[model samples]
Target: MGKPTGFMEYKREKTKEQPPLERILNWNEYASRLSDESLQTQGARCMDCATPFCHMGIEVRGAAAGCPIQNVIPEWNDLVYKGKWQEALQRLHMTNNFPEFTGRVCPAPCEGSCTLGINEPSVAIKSIERSIIDKGFENNWIVPRIPSHRTGKKIAIVGSGPAGLAAADQLNQKGHSVTVYERADRPGGLLMYGIPNMKLEKEVVERRVNLLQQEGIDFVLNTEVGVDITGEQLKNEYDAVILCVGAQKQRALHIEGSESEGVHLAMDYLTGVTQSLLDSKFKDGKALNVKGKDVIVIGGGDTGADCVATAIRQEARSVYQFGKHPELPKVRTDETPWPQDPNVYKLDYAYEEVAAVKGRDPREYCIQTKKIVKDKNGRVKELHTIQMEKVLGEDGFYYFKELPGTEKIWPAQYVFVAIGFEGVENKIADHFGVNLVRNRIQASIKDFATNVPGVFVAGDARRGQSLVVWAIKEGRAVAASVEEFLTTSVKA
Candidate 1:
């Protein structure tokens, strides 16, 4: 819906990042916003495809194809192209409660399914979206919109991650009184600790949280729901309780010596570093110190990449990341056709940082860790690994075949496992009496009601580990269900 011919005239330009070597010196957001003019030009690259798949917001083959929150990509792109910055921001906020968060961290599946991306590079949707909201904040256009009237329906939301925050915001906007509970000292769950500051500054998260508080949502921090207040107590106190507790039960390495000292979960390492940075800038010596030590991160994906970046920032003597998947092709493959998120090889920010300093990418694909070797004092001393080849099996499935002769040992003092999470932690689910299916809270999407009446579940707790965008989508959906339940069933 942008300039009909603009897509042919202009090439896509991505948000610029500070040089890797320079940015690794500090834990601050390294990406720089493109100029307004450049963004408008990028926006013009949105083609007027008869069917704009960029906003389809569907899943194909278990992978997201477009904006899960159903952001009207073409409309906002047109507005931005026409220099209607405020209007673009309005369109962005209509679906996404936090464009800033998504803009900064979202992998942007929307761009993957862009019609123009079939042959050419996709429109800079993520950057344009980020610019619009950022401009709104800069020009004082975004403010807390206090609900005109209170419905007196109180909602207790457990977990302050993206899902919880989005649900809280939506429920508050719908005139329901909302209180969010976080076990951590801070309000933002994943945004606060799970992510490093270099990717998203804490102040950015705090800013949105402060606005939410001003909009009449209550945040009870450092209080675990099951430990501090039981689920039954919350159900009695509030009209409804929604669980947004993320899937944080990390999958562990089953290999020998996995329990050795100096081995840590990626989330633990990230949370500790962020907490220490916020608490005392690591002056208290509480943060994990990888300085001058050889570090190896096991597993791959965004979490593994984040571990690599954090290790680099900590001045590790050397860093290496291991992944079981083979390196992706440089271009989109038939296996992942258009309208599906492209599986292609591009250097992530973390890989770029490592390459800048080491003169080579630190990721070793198609490798599997066999064991963690411990030293005399029982700390991690080395890692044993073997190369693997992906083979198509007779059952029409692919399996990894280990190459026996390729076994090797690498020196390491720290081993961060970033294999990802299994599902929701059991304590909260058990305490709430919510039924779990495959470790995820069992709730139908039609109505996110758990087995317990008046209690609902959303986000990763219900859907398992997923993107922040998906979590926000669930949060919004569950809020609607809660609103209907409160109106139709609850007594004033």
Candidate 2:
């Protein structure tokens, strides 16, 4: 809207990234910020479309079509183009509590649904968003907003991930006392451990957590609610309890020899590496060492890509990632039309780094692991596999059909399963006496209220594993629900 013909005048230019060969040597974030002038030009590329689907925040065909948090994309783009950095940051925070986190790792479904993307490349919305938030921090524009008055009500939030943090921030700003419980040593649950530093630096997470603390939110770290503090105690101490303890039960590969030594879940491997890196920079020898070992990662997703990047940084001898599904098409398919999150192929950061060093992409599509062949000592030595073909059945659903006589074996000392999470851990939910539906906490999206009184659920715990932006949305929604509940209960 800032420049009507700007989309036609300027081509989309993304932020610069460190060369894969150079960045793989260290764990720092590889992407560099675009200059202010360049970001302004990119912002100007936002088309003044009447029907802007960029912030619709709806799911199309089970995939996110736009920003889940409903970020005001056009307004911020206009603000940035007009050199109103502070205003842009304010508009950004109006929807997203953690733009830095989502900006770095969210996959950017908003871009897939961008109006300009139907014809040309989408405006660099994500890059401009990161620039606005980063500038806000750099210029000291963001500060603690301590509540002037207390609502005389206490709320306890279980988990310190994005959802929990967002809920705590919202509730605290509304003058309610909030305490966030975290089982980990640090405040950020997934952002601190599950993600590698090269993608989302821990310092960024810590900076926000510190700000929340200054805003009168209490953080209780290294304490599990169900174990250290019982549900009854929480119910008695706090006016209400909100559960944001993400879906963390990793799905296990049930093939033979999967229980062998040197075979691990992807999240476990990532958490160990990140913890060790922070504790002693890996000098503690706590991290799983893949140095000089041929590594194989099963499951073709972002977690698998993260494992590939981590192994490369640890100097693995060889690395390969397997995906049962075939590679995505270069262009959008019939199943994913315009405004849907495009199921397209592009080199991810990990694949790029591996390609630079290995002279080939490390991904093997349509490959499924048959079993893990182990040595006499019970350590994984070879990964057995077979190719697969996607075939449509008479039922009109596509399924993977294994190709006969295409079996192969590959040498591997370490095998990591990155097949994704199943649901919440269940232990905490059981203690809280919340109902469960298909592994998720039984809570309605309308109110985020559980069957039990004074207890509510949100985020992955209620909706299953999803994007950080979605989690934040649920967090904000649950906060409003809790506030209304508190107000009504007082009147009752």
Candidate 3:
């Protein structure tokens, strides 16, 4: 729709990034925006297929296959190509409330499902999206839309993460009084703490939260729902309640020295560093400092990469990342075919820094931590690891097989476990009397309504840990459900 021959004319290109070594010197965003001409060229590459799978918003193998928010990719791509940036921004907002967050953090599943990607590189959809919203902010196109009339209904959103914020935004737009509760000192939940600043700056999150405040939504910080206030009080006070509390129970590492002073959870390490950076700009030395120390990061995911980057920034003497699974193929394999999210190898920003400064990548594949040896003072001093191989089991599945004579030990002064999370904490769910299926809150897929009347669930609390895009999608959908429930209940 952008241009019939646009795909044939323009090749795919993305924004450039600062050199890894130069970027590692500070805690700021490394990727720079592309020029207008280049962005327009990238937008022109959209084929606008008869059936654009890029915005279908389906799930494949527990991962998003396309834009979960079902963004109007082709329409905005056309507007950007024609230099109608404001119009492009308008189209973007129709589906997504905060494109800035998704633009920075989303893995760009839309590109993976692009029709052009069937053969050549896909159109630069994510970059175009980032440019459009950033341009909107520059031109002052984003502003609070205060509802003219009130519905005389109140909604309580427990958790200020993406899901809770999105739900609050939608409900407020419909003229309902909405309040968001955050247990942290600040709002934005994972966006504010769990993620490091280098990947997504804290100010970016604050900007959106500020706009929500101006739009008539109330935010109560440092107040948890189940603890500070009784569940009965919330149920009696509000017309309806929505739980967006994230699944943040970090999985425990049962290794020998897990409780050592120097061993910490990845979330705690990241949160402490970010909080200290915000509070005193790191001058207070309140955060975990790993300077001149050997660091070991367990589990190889985005969180592990972030931990590695953070330690490097803190001037760690050395950093090592251990991944249980073997490295994936550089190219897409038959296991993950075309038009799906491929499990191909990629050098994320943090790993790039490790390679640049250390003169080699620090990842060790097919490895498992056996124990964390502690010094006399109860601090981690060494990490024992074992090499692993894949072996077929009786169930006809391949599993990690520990090799007999491949034990090794490395000097480690600090250890960060970045394995993952278990599920939503049971306290809040039990307090609210909501059922749990496999530790996740049980809510009907049809309308997000829980087993208890007028109680709803969304995002990680309901669906387990997932992408930010999915959280936003769930937020919007759950808002509609709340609206329907309110209307029908009133009529009855």
Q: Local error of candidate 3 at 191, Å?
A: 0.5
Task: Assess each prediction's global lDDT (C-alpha) against the native.
Answer: 0.93, 0.93, 0.91
Global lDDT of model 1: 0.93
- lDDT, candidate 1, residue 283? 94
List, residue by residue over 1-492, the lDDT tens digit for candidate 1.
Answer: 888899999998979899999999999999979998999899889998989899898999999999999999999999999999999988899999999999999999999999999999999999998889889999999998999999888999999999999999999999999999999999988989988898889998999999999999999998997788898899889999999999999999889999999999999999999999999989999999899999999988898899999999988999999999999999999999999999799899999999999889999999999999998899999999999999999999999999989999999999999998999998988888989999999999999999999889999989888898999999999999999999899455
For candidate 3, write residues 1-492 as lDDT tens digits.
Answer: 687898998888857788988988999988868999898888888996898889989988777787999998999999999999999999999999999999988889998889888888888998999889988988999988999999999999999999999999999999999999899999999999988998889998999999999999999989987779867788788888999998988998997889998889999999999999999999999999999999999989988999999999988999999999998898878877767887789888888899999988889999999998899999889999999997889999999989989999999999999999998998998889999998899998799999988889999999998899999999998999999988877532
Superposition error at 192 for model 1 (Å): 1.0
What does candidate 1 score in Cα RMSD to the true structure?
0.8
* Model 1 quality (TM-score): 0.99
lDDT of 2 by residue, 281-348 (tens): 98999999899999999999999999999999999999999998888999888889989988799999
**Model 2 misplaced regions, further than 4 Å:** none
- Candidate 3: worst-modelled 10 consecutive residues by lDDT: 483-492
Better of 1 and 3 by TM-score: 1
- Once fitted onto the true fold, the runs of candidate 3 whose alpha carbons sit more than 4 angstroms away are 392-394, 490-492
What TM-score, over all chains together, does every model reach?
Answer: 0.99, 0.99, 0.98
